[model samples]
Target: MYCEITYQTTGERWGIFPRDIGEFQARMSIPDSINSGDSHDTIVKKSVKIEIMSCSFTPDEKNKRHREALEGLVDRLVKAGWEQMTERGAEWYNIKFHKEMQK
Candidate 1:
């Protein structure tokens, strides 16, 4: 059996901190048994795409410093293993950041 998994964030309130985010949703389409003799190689081959939609934000000089500080904090978190997804093909991983004010 073939399957796909998707993860998304909803009702998100983007800010300088990670805790300011909202709920996350993940959908999985995979077999229950690993002994089914099927391979998940295709899932790894298709490449994963992440999308953030319907977002708006603007930063001024004051907020710019805050954003930069947030970036450094996120970098430390990634090094600490906060990452949820990793690529099988690459030795390195990917992370994304956004500058937005959530209401």
Candidate 2:
């Protein structure tokens, strides 16, 4: 399973997180992966889509359970001001954000 983050405004991709960040409350909350670490900075407010792909193949018990977990994660994140991207064909968001974060 995978979870991807993107900036909705510019269609810029943030980063793609695997099941490591997909587990329920693993980092205490899914959005913590995107947090600035400075509480005073505040959330970007502009919406972001945290897309989860539980299956790139035919469904199976493992994938089904994975999908369920992703769905729950998405729901919790959405309530925290993020949104979901339902456009299956949406292009990848900008890669620079991911690159910069690596530095």
Candidate 3:
């Protein structure tokens, strides 16, 4: 099975393997830093889409079950204000405001 996880922040894209979902979440956990405390940051919003390809699984499973799970995870992140970047064909979001805490 192959999966392309697209993030739409800074237009950067990342390729994700089915088994590497943990790694993907970890990578996204990194916080972004900005200089100038006087500067007020503007929020960026983006739409998300998860594209998947599985040889063994039926399309219904991929689109319904697996995709739902993936979107659910993403929804949790997005609610925290993660926006996607468009880079290459993949999508990525820039999330760097929250201080590092235990997830």
Candidate 4:
């Protein structure tokens, strides 16, 4: 599966795999490839995308992970920028309410 991570601030985007979809993971970590910042606090996160192929996991598990990943991104984005939005394929989930961001 393929996914995209769009930045609401710089409008910069990138593509990542399943493990790269969440926080504290290797790809999005402070010392991972594609990292644009030196510190975690200064790192800018615009959005994250994940692809799930098979039905090995339950819906609840999938939802939980997705939410956790999103929340982590929001936390990072709060310090990086105020305006951010995420679009999971065709569905859009606004994290501005949880963390005061422009959109």
Off by over 4 Å in 3: 1-26, 29-61, 88-103
lDDT of 3 by residue, 1-103 (tens): 1112333222223456332111113132222346434333332322333333323221233345445644564576557654433432312222232323445
* Pairs of residues clashing in candidate 2: 12-93, 12-94, 13-93, 13-94
When sorted by lDDT, best at the front, the candidate numbers are 4, 3, 2, 1
Q: Is candidate 2 or candidate 4 better by TM-score?
A: 4
Candidate 1 lDDT, 14-89, residue by residue in tens: 4553222221112223343657665333221111222233352222224444344334544544453344333321
* lDDT tens readout by residue for model 2, 14-93: 34632121232211112344564623322222222233343331222255554554455555556654445454224232
Model 4 ranges with Cα > 4 A deviation: 1-51, 54-62, 83-90, 94-103
In candidate 4, what are the lDDT values of residues 1-103, reduced to their tens digit?
1122322222222445222222222113233346656434233344354333223221123476556656666566556534443433332333332223243
Tell how far residue 61 is off in model 1, in angstroms: 9.5
Candidates 2 and 3, the one with greater lDDT = 3
Output the TM-score of candidate 1.
Answer: 0.22
Q: What C-alpha lDDT values do all the predictions have?
A: 0.31, 0.33, 0.34, 0.36
Ten residues in a row with the worst lDDT in model 4? 18-27
Worst 10 residues of 1 by lDDT: 89-98
